[model samples]
Target: MSDGDEPAVTGEEVRNVADLARVDLNDEEVETFAEQFEAVLADFETLDEVPEIESEPDLVNVMRADEVEAGLTQEEALSNASETEDGYFKGPRVS
Candidate 1:
């Protein structure tokens, strides 16, 4: 679509953003994106008209229970390690 049929979001801004994003866009694509961006912004602006809630709703934990479970044994865990010591994987010591 041409910029004439598009809303207020400018093609220059779209092109600038595309440049910033390292996107390779031609003239037609920039104009189309500028129009789309304007429409999207208008849609999001409707959220501003929604009435504010007076109080917060109760919130609760929604997670799985944590429990100890059997996993790979020490020897199995360190089987791929280049070095192991005292049933633990060994790595270079850092100061």
Candidate 2:
């Protein structure tokens, strides 16, 4: 296909992308991917042709009110802990 106003996808770009992904593609596969990538870019250009949307939809928060809730205390939470130190659960230190 002839090159358009936008730069055409290149086999080198396809190969580079494949290499970054650790994909092993032959020369023919690279050419195929380049064509496919070019088609995707061409399709994306269609977005520019879409008419601007004028209407705006009403937006509102749909969440419950935040409120204080009862929870287990330090002693109660530590009860299930195999190791506790300074009124809290002690875990193995990770370097």
Best by lDDT: 2
Winning model by TM-score: 2
Q: What is the alpha-carbon lDDT for the whole of candidate 1?
A: 0.85
Residue 56 of model 1: what lDDT? 83
Q: Mind giving the per-residue lDDT tens digits that candidate 2 earns over 3-50?
A: 566448888899889999999999999988998998888788887789
State TM-scores per candidate. Answer: 0.53, 0.55
- Cα distance off (Å), candidate 1, residue 68: 14
* Backbone collisions counted per model: 0, 0
Q: How does model 2 fare in lDDT? A: 0.86
Pairs in steric clash, model 1:
none
